[model samples]
Target: MPAFPNSCFQISVLLLGLAAGPGLLGCARVVSATTSAAAADCLVYVGTNVASEQENTIYLYRLQAATGTLTRLDAQPGGAAPTYLTMDAARRHLYAVSETQTFRGAASGGVSAFAVDKKTGHLTLLNQQPSGGGAPCYISLDRSEKNVLVANYVGGNVSLLPVQADGRLAPAASVHQHEGRGPHPNQTSPHAHCILPDPSNQFAFAVDLGTDNVYGYRLNAKEHQLAPAAAPAFTAAPGAGPRHLTFHPDGRYAYLINELNSTITALQYQDRQYEKGPAAFTELQTVSMLPAGFTGPNSCADVHVSPDGRFVYGSNRGHNSLAVFAINPGDGRLTLVQHVSTQGQTPRNFALDPSGQLLLVANQNSNNIFTYRVDQGTGKLTPTGHSVEVPSPMFLQVVSDFTR
Candidate 1:
């Protein structure tokens, strides 16, 4: 933990004053005290793609927790086209996928590891390994933090990489090639979009957009391997192109956002196993992410459940809005709440701060990040009018000091 200078403290106080009113007197006090604490160094990391004009890099920013303001800290060269990033549970290591078709002369993507400097929030490259597939787009850590799982979009496969004690990635332990296609043109071949471990840590779900199915894999922590689950896969609509999946905090329900159709499906999740069969998930309902009669072209990119599990949100690319939904506590169903504009175009990725009080959206086409304040009670979002310009910002992640 470090102390801020007098000038930094004054600036923080002034910004907090402008963001909150007298009605938030009690909250303001807590925020001020927390921001002043030596351990209040929150960090934000943004991953950008390498285009003709853009460099493959990961930019670091220091977050003013009290005001949702981000101050540039540093930038490091991420390997070729870093599309997605993930941090280890200890917050000491960062992992990113270099979405390339060739790695070390092989037809595969690459994953790089970086060591996080807690004091300055700087990242230092550690090592790199083959992603076991081509065009790896997503990476995530297992609940045990013993392995890193990656999804390859172009190769349509999922791979697991063992994590070493020093935070470097070992060669992939296993790679599972996906099979099948969907009705959409983009589904000519398999396209694994996201890999997320279940809350129970017993299973991992890989969403394959091209297959129109979510494949489940049983995690073997001891062996550091992944095997097809007893209940292998859950099928979506013909051309749904399910891209992302999220689970309720209670672990009783899950939601999937379909990119091709711009719809979300709710499912009842049960972890119980019977002598006759394995655990299963039952589809509960499906709802459109767009407004009625607004039949323009749109695609969904992200989905997340609120910290409280009382609400869920889906990001629409063409609509340039966030679709909010209220969660039914009784049956895990969802009801449309509101659609709030993101104030930018092509919001490729967004993240909620550690406190769940603020949301930041990275608009790729607009090249700006928009901030929004969350209404905890009603599950609505209001723009905070706090935005920062960046280049080709595709992924945003928040790492809290406390977690570190």
Candidate 2:
């Protein structure tokens, strides 16, 4: 692939159930916030929470995709605590969950859609619907982009919404209720954190942070419904506290990150489905996020696989670092490679550029986005000296043709 040009053009479509596959196109430098918005050829959006604001705000930024500079685009108040966000496959729409608050004239949490105006880098609010749970902290669009799914942290449930022809969101077609208890004291109840559709989109998997189990949902696209998979949830270690999981591009492997134990578990997803016990979920390996001899309050926030499927990375809150690992493609195992400091506190989330040549780290507590160049050969990250300053930045995702 050739180097990205001076001006980057990214456009993201906002809708439901859309899937941006594990593999990505190449990416250039993003626009720096210090520069003029006119210098940017692509738009970037960040979700944040700050007091004295109307819920959580979505800030629009234009990135000089080639130069890596960011220009602030028009921003608007999205909803209450829009902590996590995902964009549709077409790069034409975006979806965000209201982390907490009343919606539709009640105490229900909310999820909403916005149509992306590529030319002006502005968002047109489309529609909003209750998340069926309170404080939705994570959201994902399925491969079809037809269903918008949300996981509520405090509400302990998951909701699925349908995407309309006009890019609007309809009320949830199906919702799942999680119930369980783990080892820890606070873990005595379900704290549904995230739901990810399997690569096949035939099923969905959700992790309950408090119970340390990943729940499986059978996808019924025809009727827009989700039924519990035969073995609804798979249990992790006593207190590992499963937080999130990402599947390998080949769909043969799954990697899960735990929040409490601050460790990651690598698994070999059953090569074949089962009519017996439970789809044969087995654990292959485990590794901790922190280096030995380090003691602190454990809070592992996010995790992801390198576009090539050869590497995985996870973020640690108290440790404030990214734990990198080299994945063994043959056996679906992982070898710890490196742990890089994020250069800020509480790296709420991190994103790899479309090309997998760069990394953008969002430190929510420090209000900064640090960009790092990824070494294709070694899968290591190097500081690019390019960064953006935003207020309480929480999540990052790439969009191409954003100027449309």
- Best candidate according to lDDT: 1
lDDT of 1 by residue, 164-190 (tens): 999999999989998889889999999
What stretches of model 2 exceed 4 Å from their correct place?
Answer: 1-43, 63-68, 274-277
CA lDDT, every prediction? Answer: 0.78, 0.73
RMSD of each: 9.9, 8.5
Model 2 global lDDT (CA atoms, 0 to 1): 0.73
**Tens digit of lDDT per residue, candidate 2, span 56-130?**
688876555464556676778777777778887676778888776567777678888988775665777888889
Model 1 pairs in collision: none
Q: How many collisions per candidate? A: 0, 32
Q: Provide the TM-score for each candidate, comma-separated.
A: 0.88, 0.87
Error of 2 at 401 (Å): 4.3
Model 1 weakest lDDT span, ten residues long: 8-17
Residue 109 local lDDT, model 1: 94
